[model samples]
Target: MAKSDTDIPAGARRRLLALAQERGASLAGLSELLGRNPSYLQQFIRKGSPRKLEEGDRRTLARFFGVDEGELAEAREKSYGATPPLGAGWVEVPRLDIGASAGPGALPAGEGAFDAFRFSRRWLAEHGLEGARLSAITVEGDSMEPLLNDGDEILVDCTERPFRDGIHVVRLGESLMVKRVASAGGGRLSLLSQNLAYPPVSVDVADVDIIGRVVWKGGRI
Candidate 1:
């Protein structure tokens, strides 16, 4: 019997699942990335013959996998040898406003410490992070100017870990600092500022809480 409009082909779901796993995600991980219910995803994947994915769901899944929508859809149609059409759907990722990361010897969790910013969910999903919860904050002061000037828009992903030397947004105790992370001693990390005016800050491993790694930044001249 032919499937109805709402039903997705079983093959499509299998291929989609396989593609997601290939991209380093488990079913549980996918649920967290897509902000979907785990049980629902399990049931959805368990169908003897899955139905075709909805446009919105397909887009979400594709964005999560960091692949073009057509690539995901085409995998299931390999036998046919025709390229899959691109999927059309997107969501925005919001930004949080952090007034300031605790600066030198400041305590944590003080009042008026952080703020949030608004952004498009679709734009954020288009990048590598879809399921990640993000917050927006405006960059202030020239502490990190030139590269990331004051008033630049920054999107923060709290779930990501800081690994190797790269740009990251961090809250050391109560102070927020945007600096390059580098190896210190043992497991300790150093926050380096490019401006040179600020010396390298070597922090004990226990005192640092990396809010998120900075993926991208946008600001006006």
Candidate 2:
């Protein structure tokens, strides 16, 4: 018998569990990435607690998996190779093998190339983003919590240079880092953390290289 709409999400939940495993991530990791308690996804999956995800959470999961948002509910592979098509406005941006830290210090640059991430061109334009100057990087540590959590993948607009006050990826010496950047009135910049326990870092603008502004972020959830 076909499942009723009210019962559809159980199968979806089961599929999501499998998807997480295929991605080599855990329920706890997905929950934390969505800014939910560690057991949030566990409860939802094991108990069918929510039945359906909130709209925002659904969108997040879709973006993270690089799939159509509706697929999460469909919870099955495309039939007869008849996959849903994306709109013509959709575009993809490259993701580099780079990381930006929300805490202290950073990751050394590695081989910087990967398949690009797909997004709607209209959505990018809405956010003042240009695909040519954009790339995705991972965020490490929890210092940017309540904003950008650890393991979050953020999109950076390399063309959005000549930095102003906002979140940005910056390079100092051999390392690249992510922090809130604000002008210091003397051709200097201050890197601040969302976590109060971490102190602000000051640096001369000329002494460091501003990689790009953090335009967007997505994590598994």
Candidate 3:
């Protein structure tokens, strides 16, 4: 029989709690980890009530556990027998002024470097991009408009490598640019821009530095 959304067995909840603990996450921390209200999460765990977790939410948790979504779902289903004691181990991540998102090469100015914001370790563990590391920066110009608007918060994975396709932030000489990468052969590549007003630029592979690959974009509605 298909279980109702609210009918998720007790085992599943316990396992979830355990899993969060194992991943160094606490209930209070998980709420903050996901940028959710702490009281809401407390109620959620205390009541064993169900909430529809979106794909992004699932992805966030899956990433935190270092497991895939399918695996997480299966674990939940299999572990639905008992409520385990609440275990806790969630930490917070602080936001740091790493750089300014003007094109790409614009580094942070005075009081920018070493500045940090608080974030949940649980959230970072789950949603951290693969290969590419997370680096927070505020968007600046309109050259990469529509897709990336000014003042939008972005997570860049610096550890990621650049492929011929997809948008990327690159540094060429003194200028940094956010554009599409296209292989031009002979150790060269072309940087393309979406905005018609901006002209595309070509360069040698040696001169270009891939600062990071933008995996997700966060903005105010």
Candidate 4:
């Protein structure tokens, strides 16, 4: 007989619940978003029916929540166990589970780091990023094509600073995105995209939440 959901570890369920609460999303809505019946997640969480989430479903949830797939229990147990210690002269930088949309928008979710990358201390100092809080996130759309491609991982400097003309991650309302930001004068700003197909949008500086500046990017060639 298959194990009941309640009989299995609850890490993934707890994490999902916390994310749902943080985003003010109902489980039924999230289930529908997953293309499942309204009671799918409700039953999975509350009634403990499906002992484990399907891999495809788990991947979708990971993308939607901006978290690593490993954070979702099964994968966590199979692969994302304890991380080894870092080598000398290397510093660990968290790779956030979030994705900064390069297209329309991606809802912000999970603020925790699901994985990390090691950087050379000297290289960090050379880039003037020493002691600066940094995070790595994946780009989710093709809006910033040529410069930033879909699935590209970017390093962001999270230190607070006055707005400057550069590629930065900004939160507009409930969505998080990465775009070329420039001053539009009169306390307004322009969110530009590299892809001409997508036109720019203008908004008040005060209305946007500047998460951080994109310092570097790496992706498949």
Candidate 5:
């Protein structure tokens, strides 16, 4: 008998989500990579479909996640389980399940939800970043190439008010984008990109809201 979606073990779901976050991927993107509908994995996570992942799908996911196929299978057979509690000296920073375009603008369907990722407090302190104002987002385009690649996850410092010269995530009009912003002063700001093909876009500082300044970037590899 196939397991119902509601029967998916909590540990299994957590493991999958952790793997996805580590790889800077979404369930929807992972489903497409496996040649399934974009929503296949999402349904399994949120609604439980196909009862159990087919052997091929399971194998592919296991390899991509750098885990043994048996591990995933084990998760399916087990019941919901408790996760390890975070140890002292570790701080969890919110990584929003949202994509920020480094190239063209993107209009997210809805606001993002944050699922915190634990980091070493020492490491964060060394970098001079406050975990309170830190949030993460996935890069979706190539405009900020060389620095931020597609699929790379970036941490934005929401408390870094007073924009200056740096790469920033901003919401211009209805579209949100990540770009290299330079202050033109006099109430104007310039959005630049590493890719010369994009040219430069200038806008009034008031017209575009600064989301945050990007402080860190990471990718699966």
Candidate 6:
């Protein structure tokens, strides 16, 4: 039997369609990415065949899209009678009005919360990031292009930890920058950039201040 549009959650359908269009992804390509038949997503979105996405399929789509799984799930209309409040199974992470330079360096200016983004508590816990001090900052410059782009929002885990190899927000003198920090040996660290145009910089560990580790990043498609 064919399902009607009413049978499918409007929010999920619209969100998926918008993301697909923004990313320039065809329904057939997305279906193949999900390991499904070529017409799977087309049927779901156009014909409303499934009514709602399956749990596994939704999870995969959420990860691929760099969004919370709840975003892809059917919004609970009865819970709030509209959009749910941030307090409802969601954690408010502040978006700092500062840009962490991906190029040379950007001075840390206006370190205030200009806005906030809400994430599912369940999603945070699943990622082993529960109870971690999290904040968001914009990425600046093209040095980290192809990975972290200019204007991209990155979720930073501010929980202090011993230096390990990973992308992190570092402070050198008065400038704050985001780079892939790896041990250069002899008590020095190498700040690497994604773009080959920018060469890796080696500096003494004591000269750099680790602000936070970049856990996740999101950018416009």
> Among these predicted structures, which one has the highest TM-score?
4
Encode model 3's per-residue lDDT on 88-184: one tens digit a residue. Answer: 5332222334433445346433212233333445554577632224545667677677788777766555553536467776666645556777888
lDDT of 4 by residue, 1-221 (tens): 65554564567776777788788989899898889999898777765567657656777888888988667764333321122336768877877777899999998565557779898988888999877777788999999999999999998887767768999998887688999999999999999999999999999987787778999999998
User: What's the ranking of the predictions by lDDT, best on top?
Assistant: 6, 4, 5, 2, 1, 3
Q: Which candidate number has the best lDDT? A: 6
Deviation in Å, model 5, residue 72 alpha carbon: 43
Candidate 4 — worst ten consecutive residues by lDDT sum?
75-84
* Cα lDDT computed for each candidate against the true fold: 0.56, 0.72, 0.56, 0.80, 0.73, 0.81
Question: 1 or 2, which is superior by lDDT?
Answer: 2
Q: Any runs in candidate 6 off by more than 4 Å, and if so which?
A: 1-88
Residues 1-221, candidate 2: write the lDDT tens digits.
54433553456686677678789988898888889999988878776777657546766887887776556653321111121224678766656666777877785546345556778878877877634466777898888887998989988777734657899888776567889989987778898999888999999986677777887899987
RMSD of 4: 9.2
RMSD of each: 14.2, 16.1, 18.6, 9.2, 14.6, 17.4
User: What is the per-residue lDDT of model 1 for residues 4-51, given as tens digits with 9 covering 90 to 100?
Assistant: 424644455666667755776677766655676765455556663234
What candidate 5 gets wrong by more than 4 Å, as runs, is: 1-87
Ranking of predictions according to TM-score:
4, 6, 5, 2, 1, 3
Give the better candidate number (3 or 4) by lDDT: 4
Across 1-221, the per-residue lDDT of candidate 6 in tens digits comes to 76554564578787888788888889898899889999999888876677768667887888888887667766431111121236758988878878999999998656667678888989988987877778888999999999999999999887757768999998887788999999989999999999999999999997887778999999999
- For each candidate in turn, the TM-score is 0.49, 0.57, 0.48, 0.61, 0.58, 0.61
At residue 85, candidate 2 shows an lDDT of 26
The 10-residue segment with the lowest total lDDT in model 5: 76-85
Clashing pairs for model 2 are none
lDDT of 5 by residue, 4-69 (tens): 545656655556766887899989999998999998887776655655576567679998988975
For candidate 5, the clash count comes to 0
